[model samples]
Target: MEKISSTKNSKVKEWVKLKTNNGRKKFKKFLLEGRHPVETALEQATEYEFLIVQEDFDLGELAEQVDNDKLILVTKEVANHISDTVHDQGIFLIGYINEEDWQFPDDLSGKWLVLDNVQDPGNIGTMVRTADAAGFTGVVFGDGTADFYNPKILRAMQGSQYHLQLKRLNLEKWIRNCKDQGSVIFGSILDENARDYRKIDVPDQFSLIMGNEGNGMSERLIEMTDMNLYIPIKGSAESLNVAVAAGVLMFGLAG
Candidate 1:
């Protein structure tokens, strides 16, 4: 174990850079704060590179749960400097995120959720978590979606990202590929041509496309889908949040 007391230490500075998106990309690594995500990372067997702890923080529970040789102790100020959250947990994990070269799975027999240009981190994260809870196969992030490793998203996902397949692909290409593979594609768009989602006979395996927060599905994707499905708004509200709509569709289709 090494002691890193100063925020200006070389190692501390390097780790601190991970607080930024570009920094994480540059280093091919990210920081996991608080006890839950770190524990979840260990449990899921994610690449655990190293651990940073506050000098006076209690590590008894974490130590018993996760045994790691690369523990670095730092002062409270250093921990605060590295943590983005207001309530700093004092425990951080330096983990590597190996972006997988995910080809369209050869077996596309399970349900999947596709997100297109969904910019809100909270919405993206919640949708992924919802997909996991609904027992969907995976969630694909299309162009303009929020970063999967964003701290806000990481917190919103509540560690469910580790449980399911997450991939980044040109959604247009992905849709065409899935369509060629005999998979049914459904786009959520509220239009005259669209059918009520409840009326359609849900297929055993399918891909549901949830569009951007402000706009529904992209016109290009809407044209490409097998059918455009819409949920009727009976209330005074104009529309549901993208994540809420996704949950309704996911669980309904899964059932």
Candidate 2:
């Protein structure tokens, strides 16, 4: 295995760049940190360029799985410089981002979670993980939503991203496509005409739109949805967190 001792190493500088969106796009790679996510990526046969570990970090079974050519050992200082967390795990993998153009299918089916300008990395990760648990087929990231490559978002996903389909596209065009395919689109919002979430029958294949944390869904999207839903708040609390609301609706409507 190759060892990199200097924080100023050429490759070390490149790895640090993976932390940002532009860097990821430029390099066509993103950093996967921690044991679970790195292991999960390996198990899923993700295309990766390197399995990075701190000098003293134990690889254990992982040592047997990765080829020596793909392994790189870094000093503590190098690891610290590349880490995005308060407590770095000292293990990471650099995985290639899929650059193939994703074409929307002619026939759309299965339950999908749609994010409309949701910005929080934690919330985005929670919602994606929740969608996986709820057995949703995929997730769509609309304009203004956080990028999937964000380090915090990747960590928040906890490797759930590997199990589900994720896409970024214009919401207006996506909604129109779903409409053309005869799929029901539900928007979560509190409005005079919005129906109670419990009262609506869940469809086998549909898309649920969770909007921005503060602004909610856009007016154009609201008008375009087949039906708008409101989770009636019984208590004195002002509103549900976007991630929490998504979980409730995903499982509630999943049936």
The reply for model 2, stretches above 4 Å from the true place, is 100-102, 105-107
User: Candidate 1 lDDT, tens digit per residue, 30-149?
Assistant: 888888887788788787678888888888767876655788888988899889799898888998877672456667778899998999988998999999999988898887787777
lDDT of 2 by residue, 11-38 (tens): 9999999999889979989998999889
- Reference-based lDDT, each prediction: 0.85, 0.90
TM-score of each: 0.93, 0.96
What is the Å distance of residue 135 in model 1 from its true position? 0.6
Best by lDDT: 2
RMSD of each: 1.7, 1.4
- Each candidate's number of clashing pairs is 0, 0
- Ten residues in sequence with the least summed lDDT for candidate 1: 99-108
